[model samples]
Target: MLDVLKPVTSLKLSTKPRGEGAVFKLHYRATFVFIMGCCILVTATQYIGDPIECLPDKDSIPQKVIDTYCYITSTYTLPKYYNMKVGVEVPHWGLGPEMAEDEKVYHNYYIWVPYMLFIQAISFYVPHWIWKAIQTDKVYTILMGLDNRSLDEAEKKDKENLLVKYLALHLHTHNVWAVKYIVCEILNFVNVLVQISITNAFLGGEFTNYGPKVASFLWQDPEDRTDPMYEVFPRVTKCKFWKYGPSGTVQKHDALCVLALNIINEKIYVILWFWLIILSVISALALLYRVLTMVSPSFRARILRQHGGTLRPSPLDPSARDAVDSLVHRCQYGDWYLLHSLGRSMNNLTFLDVLRALDRELNRSHSSDYDLNEKNLLKGKDVTSV
Candidate 1:
């Protein structure tokens, strides 16, 4: 089992350049790995151990037949008997008399849990896959090994100059690229909410409140409390099978089943419930941060300045400050996003230098355009005079 999980654990720990934020990584890497681990653990336990065992009332009925029948056909519990005294009123908390009025809450979902978790792991990773598809190593291609501090000074400067020229040529071109990434982030938030709803429905609506009820159960006095885990995933259930007696009359056989798998299941679900809740909150905050950076130019400027280590108490020179503000105003959101990603990979000083060089390039391009337009106007005036 440990051998099976080693690759997944290593994948989660693998280091790479920061193409995504911590929250984004949390969705694709940490959560996906954790859910996959759960799926493997549950699958191992289901296959390697006795998931369900049943005891029949009749000695004539073979144990193997009863066990197989109960496991496949399904086992159930009476919810109304849960609070009854174990020994006197009912055989167990959820097992009792088969009255027509009593509700038969079936325990069929356990068999599908491992498969559901596997599907969920894949779902968690979908947004990241979409991001990678759209991103297409654009940042990596642009950086071109400049992120490495081991590069000699001349090589690094050459790469920086090339990158500056590329930025100048592609000004305002990254808006769609940046929007695609933000859409992926939004998809992450949507995925969590959708999974929560799906899992709740799968668990027969117990999953939505599973975490809160468990917390309440923990704080209550032990003497007065009923175990919510049992309510959600009963350890004992009842199974009914029909057989023919010696006289050829149909006889109903009731068996008490012990679902050992529920012990693992309850714990897995508790962890998932709380983790999803935390993810939803943090993902929302990440979306809000993106929104602020998009709508508020001052916020975007402050973020850029901070990234370049220019937001200290010591103010920048008047010309430098104006240059930074002008760059922020002239560039689209995509340009700022690409720069931010680049800043994360490059050293603080190197990133600031790149920013200054790109700003100069942009200014030069603008000045050349203005000069060409002026010359055209002068020629037009000369033609009119002639």
Candidate 2:
């Protein structure tokens, strides 16, 4: 019997399209925008435009003299590493000889990092784009029909009937859409985790591994730590010359050059790792809450009752209330949440309230129609008796 009546009941409860709002919007899109902006900003600044600065070996007098002599003899230029073109050779302070020509110098700071960020931003947006592409047009069509607020009572009653039908159809037939939306939300969190992992893959091991190192820097007395804990970006530690002094002499000089950009990258990435972790945790909790709400009868009933009381000063009509309750019971958490989220976008109202009002109007319209029909039937009977 329920299987037969379900469609008919839904038809009676059908509603009009609602106003366009935040129903289709998501927070991940905003995050994607922020990340893209960060990438652009870094690129525009030329990775903070910090140069590599190197000096003579101050501790070794002989090396200092050698450096001064070399500087005077050769063309003095800022240390730069072009592939195959040898710059200044940076000597290892404690051990090892100078850097070789075949050894790659690491001056590509602004090159890969910014591009990686741009890619990460795009990755973050993919799931959000997919979700919107799948659901937005359909939701827009559904919500658009509910926007005709100036209808007469008769028309409004008819609209409510239509809404009931739509809701019934959504609950029964379109459940897969709701499930897919929920899966998208889960994927969003998974994407974030994957992004973090990709970053960690570059950063030695765990993203949090840097935590202890950072903490040591934060708390350790500055006097106790003689050397800087972190290295700068575009670290140019050594230089080599393929040809020197017109003799075609091969020369290698071990020098120290540091860029200021590394400090900025370190601080930014540490903050980002923590921020993503928090975001993932929050996303997981929200998904759990939604699942619980959809599956737990007690919770659904409570929300319905609470929402009903808030929607009306007087107690809700029993049958109307039951119908609203059934709506929650039959729908998945994702579907219910979609309605809830849309209602929240409109402040101080719930979707169940919309249903209750529509149901009441529908009842009134039916009663009036029934009363008029009865009067006409009585008039016909009277005429026949005469």
Candidate 3:
């Protein structure tokens, strides 16, 4: 039984790029793996054993035929009978005689669960795929092997110089790249919301309230308690089949079916509901953080300062503090974002060195421009005087 889940389990264990944050990875990695694992587990249970078995009112009818019929067609339970005493008022909590006007809560979702879960898992991963497709490896490429600590000193300095030069040349060009990642984060949040809506609809609108109802179920008195899992995913349901008798008379056969699959399904859905709620909250916070970082220069500066503080516990000199502030103010959001990412990957001292070198490069370029403008003005005055 455990062997059946190896493939799904492996997906969760596989290493992924560290470019994304934990919440972002949760959508594509943890949540995707979880849903796919459930899909596989349910699918395995479906194929390995009978997911549904029915006892027909007429013993003459073959049990196999009834089970097959009930499994293919949907099953339903009487909501009114769910609270009735078992083996007295009703033979079972949800089992009772058919009525013309009684409302039926159908068990149609069980059979389609595996397929629906597969689709959901894919949906969760689509945003990650879009991010991967649109995002450039510019940050990784520009680091130029500086992230590797094994390089010889001369080679390391060469790489650092190249990185500083590249950053100085392309200071503000990465805003689009940053925006693309932010768009993907927004998509992840939207995907979770859409999945929640779709799952609610797919499960007959029981999913939205599933978590709270299940939580409240534990507090109710034993006699008054009704299993919410049973309500959404009933263990037993009713299925009716019609056939012609031997004498050419119509016969209606009602079979009480035990839906074995719902045992696994209820647990799966409940866990999924809570997981999605948490994911949505975290994703929203991540987006909010992104917005704060984009609009507030102080937040961006604080983050860079914190990153530096983490790498080197020693306080920055006054000049270094000023350099950090200048870099944050001079660079666009995209450039700052790339620098932050670079800080995470590069060696602490090397990252700080890159920052100092890049600052000097920027200052040198500005000074050169000032000198050139001065020389041009002096040449114009000389020409006019002549």
Candidate 4:
């Protein structure tokens, strides 16, 4: 997704001009939100496969699938941390009789779930870090407050110097965003584990096909607790489902088990019904809204914000509305060009506030040349000083 860079003018106008400080706020918010939202979408798809290009994994999460299982299970498990469970402990009502036909199915899902999610989560982590290589200082100059394209290019924005050229067309995202996503993955994975453990405890569901094998292993237990249901984190409440308490004391879970404890047994499903599902659905919708905005020319922003000082207009080009109306009537719709036009202008007018000040300065100047071409013409791109 290469974004064409504008010379930093060509923005839509508002009736009243705003101050430079105001434009700065708009661009800052837009830059921050756009980056965060895009990173979230990109990384979520990494394992699903849209490459931002993966970075070197510092976490040392394994390359081998089986080793990955070993690492998460051994280090990140419920009992190892506080009270966690991995895989489905409950019966698969989602499967019906097909579960009995092949007991190994559950095992397959178990291996893939962590594998895919972890890889997906980490993929974004590295690329996002790389995205920050952009010179945000210069970007701020563009976004500070550009609403009116009335200002001469020299005063409104510095020419596309080295920094802007380097960063403007970047396809990958930022590192901090990658970190945020990996944390999200850790939470999501742990949450799934908590839900499974909780369901197993309260619902007393069988692990379906793995039930016989896992149960047989449990039956060989030294204590009376032989069932996999009994493989619980001790010191935590043992739900009626489990009689086998993870073999006891030294065999107990690690610290995160405490947080996981509050989540398990029927608590997780309860929370899912009460909150997680709804929140997750909202997250999904926000992501979809982002997608639509990228694809549908008709789906313009309901509330666009002004980068320049005008009160009425925001940053969108609604005049182009009719042009995109009929799918067949369209010439090749240039998304990159449009994005550059809107994005760059917005970067300056909203972030820089180029209009009202220019109005003040124009009245103040008594120069030889009448228009912006004069040597003493007012300028405003030095935000670092501002």
Candidate 5:
């Protein structure tokens, strides 16, 4: 019975060419534009269709559209190891209320914990991959616990990084402590394995078992008083009629589930999962490569000498020379900091000396005898025998 009704109930958006000419075929593209616009309007006024909260228009349309694309792509790309049913396949309620309403809800806490945790984990962990893609922000370092050290003593501050000697000096190795990287790797690995299993069920690189999600606002009325509201969208009233009837067994009602499932089945849920899985897998691979290298002793010692840079600086290669040149260049470029400090020392400068120098520059001076304060002085020659 469902198999027959399902086709008609499912919405299809397609158009065929009428009385074909090459010029007329161009008109088909125009029809797609109209189809899209109508979809937007029809979807905009989506009418969650349930009586509980008569939404102004369906808010979940965009979400549904996203789900649809995801389902189509996933099923089209990999079909065997997947099923898109809400409660049956996922063992969890559909996200949007409308969709799940037609479906049933499990109220038992024990049954719901794993399902809820799965959803929460994915939602919490996805941002790492997205953030990693754009982490090239400027950074600054501060040398803390500063005790006085002369230039000669400062040279010894450069210690052989023993940690790197024990392991590889790779940034990827060091970043293992980051929680986001670890989680992203695990999720992504799971995602890829699932995708491959699904693809195995397909043949000729083509997929066909995929079907669209179901959408409904099915509910029965609260009272069986031969209500006329039951005539319109009879599904809702049917449930209500049972609840408020002679047999009077208490039952749970969920209008939100119906609307949510409608959107979910339409395509939003699959899309979110598909992309999230992609992000996870990519993150995992990056972390795995880093981990494998960082734990290696030979790689670690080689890496430590660069002090957080590249691997190719050896005795025979010009890289050492190039790096030394760069180091010299960097020191030369910023000689002003050193030069200013040197100048300060040469002038026997302190904080007070800096202030006095600035005052002298402003023509607000102290006596040349170095015994008089500046603010108390008149013009220079007034104190002198002019």
Candidate 6:
């Protein structure tokens, strides 16, 4: 939920001082929660119930032949093919195919489906961890210092003023470290793209024989393809099993296997693909917006002026007014620009209002001093004339 406030900074880095340290934004939290839910659903379904359901090929074989094929035996058939030895002969008996004709063989579909989902879930969180590593230490010290209320009154007040100056400088200064945040955003986009490619590559065999078909299907009219063969998540796959007969004679049996889990994979991946697209767009815009903020001082200054004009200042401490004025001068002269610290309370509006109030207080103080001196001089001149 990165809402724009006149584009001073990306919505991810709101200047509002939220009471805790968090490196990830709202959208990141939302996406993470979604992926975690998907992983849990997939894991629970695979372990708690049947991962795949197989139906026998009744049309091609007699009842006696169908009865010879054991469900228990067919279950272990996929793993044997996957773990087959280099020079070992095929088993002397066939387990028989467990699927109908329209269905196809997914090989080890059960294993790969859940495994890919788990990997995707973990990959989604990597960028957040990276951002936390970069941000937490710096943010923790500043926030902890600002929140400490037990220090000596004068010292505490000075520290508070110093904290404000530090934040103002960080916001205004565009440095290498600032670019690190932009890098994190780019990383998030890349991660999504990579994950999509990887997921497609891993699952492509289940849908098509000639490598990944997702690239070609990217714009394919979902409505035009009624055939199950064209489906990205085909429910039925033709399965082939080896039947070894007497004396090293092996008979090959072709049947269909139903991938029950493909139903889940289809729905989850469709949502994920769309979700990644949205996330990529948001991340790219946020990165661009932040980069613009860093390179354009005039842009920052204009935002500062607007903020100063619109916001009302919080109650102020007169002793800290001088320090506040100094920050204002720096920003006014374009030597520095204020940034929103992504803290729930720290924003350009609050900083500008404080500066505006300080200027008003200083002007009143000087005006009173001048009026007192002028009155004293007039009284002395009248007394001399008398």
> Which tens-of-lDDT digit does each residue in 215-234 have in candidate 6?
45555676442322224555
Better of 1 and 2 by TM-score: 1
Candidate 2, run of 10 with poorest lDDT: 13-22
Candidate number that wins on lDDT, 2 or 5:
2
Q: Report the Cα lDDT for candidate 3.
A: 0.86
Backbone clash total for model 6 is 23
lDDT of 3 by residue, 137-208 (tens): 666677777788899999999999999999999989989888888888899999999999999999889999
Local accuracy by lDDT, each model: 0.86, 0.52, 0.86, 0.31, 0.29, 0.50
Can you give the TM-score per candidate against the true fold? 0.93, 0.63, 0.93, 0.26, 0.26, 0.56
Ten-residue region with minimum lDDT total, candidate 1: 308-317
Evaluate residue 121 in candidate 1 and report its C-alpha lDDT on the 0 to 100 scale: 95
Task: Write one digit per residue (lDDT tens) for candidate 4, span 1-386.
Answer: 21211111222223222111222222223222333333333334323332111111232322243233332342122232222222243221111112223331111122232233233334323322332333233334433334455657765555333223323233233333333333443443344344445434433243222234443664574543233433321112110011124455332211211112211222212322333234334444544544554465444322122212232343385322222232112212232222223343454333223223222232344242455554334444444347
Writing each residue's lDDT as its tens digit, candidate 1 over 1-386 gives 67767767667443455367789999998899999898887766535478888998888898889989998888899878888877788878888777888888898888889899999999999998888877888888898997898999999899999999999899889998888899999999999999999999999999989999999999999877888999888888899999999999999988998888888899999999999999999999999999999999898888877874544323645555565678899999999899888888887778877888888889999999999999999999999999
* Candidate no. 3 TM-score: 0.93
Q: lDDT tens string, model 5, 324-381?
A: 3332232221121221222222222121222223223223222443445453465565
* lDDT of the structure predicted as candidate 5: 0.29
Q: Which of candidates 1 and 5 is the stronger one according to lDDT?
A: 1
For model 3, give the RMSD to the true fold. 2.2
Say which candidate scores most in TM-score: 3
Model 6 spans > 4 angstroms off: 1-27, 46-48, 57-110, 145-159, 165-174, 205-230, 246-248, 302-338, 347-386
The reply for model 1, stretches above 4 Å from the true place, is 12-18, 46-48, 87-89, 308-322
